[model samples]
Target: MELAISIIVGFMILGAIYAIHARDILSAVIAGGIVGYSLVICFLLLKAPDLAIVQIVVETITLIIMVAVVLDSSRVEAYGKFDRPAWVTAGTAVLILAILFWFLKEASAPLAPFGENSMRMADAYVNGAVEKTGSINLVTGVVFDFRGYDTLGEATVLVTAVLGVLTILRIKGKR
Candidate 1:
């Protein structure tokens, strides 16, 4: 499982690098989509099914919108010359990598062992959600009663994104 996760992380890093270094806007957008999907896979591997589902849906919508935008825009490749020395950039990147490695080493402890439910919040919700929220379905009670605002915020963001895409498409049609 660890090896699989490592391979996924490697692919994600490769996707990010491809996105950043891609000469064509369409290629970069596709690479970015790959990275986003890789993140969804990572969430699933971590046993967060809800997060994985949300990420997959959001990523799909975002990728579609981005592809539309890319198709509508000019495809000029702009390469900016770096002012800083290559060694300086390399050193900075290495330092950042080292910091990330150290942080991951220290903070990589699992919140709970694999397949174990050890979260206090989970326990609380499982035990009290029905009683407090008066809902027979604990998941529904927790989502609608306990975290309704958070869900609303997510819905609002999705609606806003759709509106933005519609507005952009309308402007493009006018041209």
Candidate 2:
């Protein structure tokens, strides 16, 4: 799993660099979207499905809006030279990302194997969720009752992202 994540991170870095160095706005946006969607895969690999779901939703919306805006605009920019300082900055970013990845790997070293549940809370949720939450569905109870605020937070993030994009796309005179 770690190996897979490392490979994905490599691609993620490449995508970000391509996004930065891309000459055209549309290509840059597409490359940026690659970086984002790659993150969703990383989240899933790390056993964080909730985070992956939210990330994919937000990334898809962002990618669509950016592509539409780039296509709609008539702006053109001359290709810019990649100076030594810019290269240094990119290198620094890569170093930071690498360090973070190392930290993530170390953090997960003690965790149980993939597909195994090591969480103490899982036992509690499974045993008493139905009676306590008054929900016939265990999944529903866990999401809405035991972890209500977390679920709300995820929903809020999705809604806020959508609304922000809509606001930016809306016409000045339109409500």
Candidate 1 lDDT at 2 equals: 74
lDDT of 2 by residue, 26-135 (tens): 88898899889999988888877878889999998988878888898954668656666887989999999999999999998999986687899889988967779998
lDDT of each: 0.86, 0.87
Note the clash tally of each candidate. Answer: 0, 0
Worst 10 residues of 2 by lDDT: 74-83
lDDT of 2: 0.87
Candidate 1 local lDDT, 1-175, one digit each (tens): 7788889999999999999888899999999998999999888998778789889999999899889989999766888878999999999999999999999887868666555767778777787666699988675787788899999999999999999979986784633
Model 2 spans with C-alpha error above 4 angstroms: 43-58, 74-127, 134-143, 149-175
The number of residue pairs in model 2 that clash at the backbone is 0
Please report how far candidate 1 places residue 72 from its true position, in Å. 2.0
